[model samples]
Target: MKGFVKNYSGIIWLLTGIALGSIAGLIFGKKVEVLKPIGDIFLNLLFTAVIPLVFFAISSAIANIKPSDKLSRMMGFTAIVFLATVLISAILTIVAVKIFPIHEALGNAQLSEKIEDSPFAEQLTKLFTTTEFYELLSRKSMLAMIIFSIMIGFAALKAGKAADQFVGFLHSGNEVFKGVFILIMKAGPIGLGAYFAYQVGVFGPQLFGTYAKSLGLYYGFGAFYFVVMFSVYAFVAGGIKGIRRYWKNNLIPSATAVGTCSSIAVIPSNLDAAKKMGIPEYIANVTIPLGATLHKDGSSISSIVKMAVVFALFGKGFDTADAIVLALGMTVLVSVVEGGIPNGGYVGELLFISAYGLPIEALPPAMIIGTLVDPMATLLNATGDTVASMVVTRFTEGRQWIDKAI
Candidate 1:
């Protein structure tokens, strides 16, 4: 039994969960929904551990990066890659709209009462929102903590020897939490099975109509972006061989992202992949998590698509200027107060409405798009995070990271 579990633990446990949960959900539906707490327990555990896990991992990664010309280049290159992916996504969104256009304006959308849009300054400040240390620890503010962690990392680098003890403590904590995360993953089949079962049971039928068409575009764009963007980044970094090697290694994170539907959920998997690929811990630790927090290519694509759908439904005409605003809005909104859990910062969709001057009624349907696209968007986001890290590592170190395990 031990040998069999060891041989196929990750795949077997999780897959069994999915299959069983889905079957049960199909048969019993809302009745089996009672088990949602089983899945919630695992998810909540991960969510709680991730705050500190990401903080220390990112801080240590940055601090340990020796100051040099390459470090400067790495920062610059990372930004370029991050923005490039998003910009490319914006472009693809135009194509996706043309290919799979949302013809009907949001007809069924109801006005939302909870329309709390933040100031641009407030949104930007949220990234480094350390004024209230407790707020930074919150789930909605993970990206904010990431910014603070990077700052701490730079300080540790300057402290050099004096910061060793502090840095070592962070390093130790990183390892410990990773182990805890693995232990938690053992329960993933149980938890995720229940979650997936309930989800499919409830929402599964919606996939057949208008929802399916839009979702197809969302997921279709994700696949196109991964193949093209990751391939392009890999080719530039290494070559055809590098692209081949990269695709070979990224299957797990790709699946995990699609399965989990949360970029934050796949951090441990990305870190593990980076380790097996022989990526430097400093580069992997910083880029993987930071990318999870910030580089939201999939979300960007979803935002653009949602914007197009809303504009079409409203019978609004879009000039190149409106398209540009959408591009910039998505980039900025996702960069700061990204849409997801902890704080429910749907600022990106809010930006969509505000930037284009759409009526309040559009938000309900726009939000519906956001919900359906989460998993597909997350998969692309996770895959891009690792690929972007690889590109950064190559340019900084002057060689591609050949997947040693491959």
Candidate 2:
């Protein structure tokens, strides 16, 4: 018992805090919201540190790879696996919504502010590139920052001996940021507890009728995917043995993701889990951080739910052939570009409204759903990266990769 407690002390404290906060929320109601600032502080600290963390971690991974072929192969397998998993998630959501139908009347909510829908080309341009260097410092330009980091990494790799010091600096910076992440996480118990208090206390009663129905479907589907689909991915990656290994090491990251509700914030835990699962350092380093930015299975699922709900609100059918095709495509794109931050679905929600030519009034409901489901969505998005690393390892290192890792 002592050994078990020692091993899981952090998780224990976190869960304890969450449990206490939830009870307080239930008993005290809206008054519990006063604790929300602690949670906000925690999230703010993470967002502030994440940009540099991503830059240093990704660039350092690229710079340290001596063989270009190895890097290329890993990247290739990573892309294939990411696409496969995200598409599977989107497809599963579509099928679920179709079988059980989730759309209901969300009532008429007026839009106070006009939405200036940008052109698709301009949106894509902004997604990948920023005019000013300082803009990349913001979380909104996460994809652009990732792209810039990759370019810098390649430049350093090609620069050969002259870039040795630069590469070392990158490594040092990566270590420093990682240390920063650890320091921030030390406050997870109180921070996440306070956040959960506000969520349950302030927003608890708002879930009713259609909103409750949508959440049930989303939460149900999310649970099924998290358990069944993740298990399937694990088995395929390493058979029965893989399944055992994955679940054993996944709990920490899973809980952390649920508590934090941010994929980028969960990267450290996922990377640590990947290591314990015997994933190669190179694969874990590249895939986990990059996956946080580029891959979002959970968001893909939410995108479909949001679309179906919007379609239903407008008294339109979501099951039309064109709607399904367009929704799946947009979900894939949205998953790639969405920030790994909390409530990152805002941009994707706007895009969804614009793509379907829906009224700006449609945005608020979807955003509400996004917020309500963000924790579970983030759980799948963040933890999926670890299993994805295993899948990538399976492909790149061959079928016997798990045995070799052991």
Candidate 3:
């Protein structure tokens, strides 16, 4: 139907592009590698734009904050719950990948750099702060830029009325760069399609196996998290009665999220589910919307899986303690910023590449994984908001609030 196409137009176009490219790769084999330059141009544009885009988007979101006592309390609880759940998801995926390692399905792409030896203190300094401002302009300095941006936002907040104009400028810049990314994403289908063609041509059919294995890993764990973890959260929120009410009312929201492949789109369904589940209006109102932007358990899981696949392909061991810690930290950051802009999935991809110091050639595969995993990710991201609202209610209103609301 027309409505269906309208809703999924972006996905349709991308899939179509990938399909066409795959056919070309199949037919021409290595000859299709000629199309890689087009993909490189697209990746280069993204790399060039992402640093400023991150600076403005994060800074503006923080700078525009309007403080209120109730809002602060709610936000404090919400941040705790959101970050905790996302971390839990990341940790679970790490455990799973260790048990059954992600196979190198994308052929042996020599895209990763060997992590340089450095003292722990030195590495920490570089991760959080750059020596010069110009260094923040590079994607490799992503975490440092994030730290700097947050500092600026908080400083602007501390300035009060005097910084109002500056806050507005940050907002304007965010919008401008957002528009710039949109313009770039208009070429996504062609670029990604060509990229896929080259990958399939060079890597051959094994590419499909890697994609399938990673997807299966994510979906299997995503389902477990959705079913088991949510039940536990609901029980913690309201006991046995809470679990019943949550599942009874959460189906529509889950369906809407999976169907739309968008957390923002499922807001209405989530609100309705929250109301039906006996979440306080204030809690649901704040948590659902904020969670759409901030909480992303599914993305955390998928990002870990993507990193595992990339590590396997690059002949690196992912089980190192330092690597796991860094992946968890990066996963949390990626989840927070995942929905910060249009075509924001690419932002997460770039973040992973930069944080891990992988070459830009690693981006296309990461992007492909993100696209394929989006619907399930949206399912967890959107529905988790509703469950998180329940947890917030338990903390703010006590255990018996659920009984009282019903």
Candidate 4:
């Protein structure tokens, strides 16, 4: 029963979130604005943990690799898999946006009136220059922090005895973060429930239909992308047999991620599933957990797709160089650096929008569409972590290690 519960907990949470969201939506239909603060609090909680969580996890993972050469190979493989997944997901999202263009214009006369009255443009400029600077300073931007931490961690690894001590400290710190993360995850359902309720209450039934086409496109592409990627991963990992057990075991984590829309919360289940795959405990501990911080295939893909949609909506074309940079930068920024915090989806998108000086008014529409697509993005993310765990385990501990463990 305990094992069964663990395996299906994600599904449970997802259903709970949906049910609660519906109830909240109905009850608070006219008071959605009041519930916005609750959503904001949840988002803040998720974001607050991201920087430290990522720094320690990645540093510790890198520090634990035995042979330096093996670490290099693992990093290389991780990079390739991460990049490939992001690119593929982005392409699928872009295609989907093009095929199913959401052209429904805003009919709210008051919306333009409100926009004109608001000082949002001035605030946005301030946010772009000042707030963004602070974000960079505090390592709020995942990409910058990731680059800094990786360089620092690598340097520490090479610093002989001093580095060893520091790395050990980071490993210990990573454990502390893990403990905090666990506590937060245990509270996830309630927090998510509140958020969903707020969303439903605020948007009402009418808004759902308004955003339906865009949302549908996002979800449709997300699903298709996940299916294709999962198939490829299974094939590469040695056919159905190697991946069969994993597929069966992925239910809880995948469901949890989908329901919560929070990848970080599913780390424990991901680690458990990786262990069940005959991945060595040492490898699983490092890779599965670390992957949670950096392996955001879904988020990266979704961001690209969202960006393309935004561009299309505005009748703009992506500059080739800019697109490449944005795609790669966002992949690293949001995944390897930011860590998989809840509401990270919003933060990452915001970072991209602000970094490139994109219009702020476009965000609301993009978010509405993106949320619908998010579940698939999260599913792909969890699947990527599972596949990455196998790849890293095989490379680090060797094929013989996996065979022997099995």
Residue 362, candidate 2: C-alpha displacement in angstroms: 0.7
lDDT tens per residue, model 4, 1-406: 6755664475467457646765878876856556556555654554566567767766776666566564676667666766666666666665565566553342321112221111435533433344343564442245555555677778777786767778889889888876765666555556556665665565455445545655666667667666676766755664565567567777888877766555666788888887777776766666666667677777776676666555544444543554555555565565654463334565566556544445444444455445556667767776678877676655566556445755
Clash count in backbone of candidate 2: 0
The RMSD of every model to the true structure, in order and in angstroms, is 9.2, 8.2, 1.8, 7.4
The whole-model lDDT of each prediction reads 0.66, 0.78, 0.85, 0.60
For candidate 3, lDDT tens digit of each residue in 1-406? 6766776788888888888888889889999889999989999999999999999999999998878886788788888999899999899889888777665443454444544545556756778888899999889899999999999999999999999999999999999999999999889899988988987887786777788888888899889999999899888888899899899999999888877778899999999999988888888988998899999888898899989887766655577788788889889999888776886777998988887777788887788888888888889988999988999999988878987997
Q: Candidate 2 lDDT, tens digit per residue, 193-286?
A: 7866775676553323566788999999999999999999999999999999999999999988876667887899999999999999999999
TM-score, ranked from best to worst:
3, 2, 4, 1
In lDDT terms, which candidate is top?
A: 3
Would you list the clashing residue pairs of candidate 2? none
Residue 6's lDDT in candidate 1: 58
- Lowest lDDT block of 10, candidate 1: 336-345
Q: Residue-wise lDDT of candidate 1 within 63-124, one digit each (tens)?
A: 77665564576778788788877777877777767766654533433122333334545655
Which stretch of 10 consecutive residues in model 2 shows the poorest summed lDDT?
106-115
Per-model TM values vs. the true structure: 0.57, 0.62, 0.95, 0.60
Question: Candidate 4 local accuracy as lDDT?
Answer: 0.60
Q: Which candidate tops TM-score?
A: 3
Give the candidates in order of lDDT, highest first.
3, 2, 1, 4
Give residue 192's error in model 4 in angstroms. Answer: 17
